[model samples]
Target: MGHAADSVTACLSKGLGASVGTIIAGSKSFIAKAKIPRKTLGSGMRQVGVLCAPALVALEENKAKILAEGLNKIKGLKVDTASVQTNIVYSDILKGSNITETHLCKILEAHGVLTMPKGPFKLRLVIHHQISESDVKYTVLHSESCNWVHW
Candidate 1:
């Protein structure tokens, strides 16, 4: 049997809505061998139920819909449609926009639009169950509204 529970947290972090968890997978013996080390990092894995329970419910929700809205509703950010086979979204900051990726990230955070930087002028946004259509809209609007960047 080749049963291994790999990085299944994406099912929750990406599909459902959980803050943290990068689970790994391995055979039984391997897992047993790592038990001591895993336990050594005890509380780091605490309160998992806080994230797991919602993930279970997320399985029943429409993951594709969110992905679609996220893909379609964006304006100022450019995404390659050909590569959007999954729930991950990458937005490239338009060149000559005058604002660097770091400054834009700070602006988005100020407006409650959280995202990760993929490059000097790129951002990675993930579509999850917790994100609603309005959230996507807000991101697009705020991102495109960087008027001061033109100067």
Candidate 2:
């Protein structure tokens, strides 16, 4: 099927959980030409198997739901667990909370957890293969601290 396309690409990060890498395929001539820019952009490297190993584990684990369920238990945060189908989870800050999503992210980061603010009141969390059950618990523990009545 690739013969019909000039080039094909797939990311090995995100859901695949590879630290970082992408697959690019094309005609031999096209690939040869592509190598120059790949190296120029510093994407060409040796021993990349180390970076690609986690994807295999990701295929066997679905940690996002675990994370989403945990987040749903936290106060001031609303998560539709049914919508969590992959490695991404989104939580919204309920109206009663004074804490914005950005503030909540900073609080989590200060406690050794990291998250991204989706909008003024939404938070985005990505559960990669590297995150263990204990890590999820830690995230939830800290997130629960944000359950302050001030929110």
Best by lDDT: 2
lDDT of 2 by residue, 61-104 (tens): 86778888988887777899999866889998888788777778
Our tally of clashes for model 1 stands at 0
lDDT of 1 by residue, 99-122 (tens): 677787888899987778888878
- Cα displacement (angstroms), candidate 1, residue 87, comes to 2.4
**TM-score of candidate 1 relative to the true fold:** 0.53
Residue 35 of model 2, lDDT score: 90
The per-prediction CA RMSD against the true structure, in angstroms, equals: 6.1, 5.0
Model 2: how far residue 139 lies from native, Å: 0.3
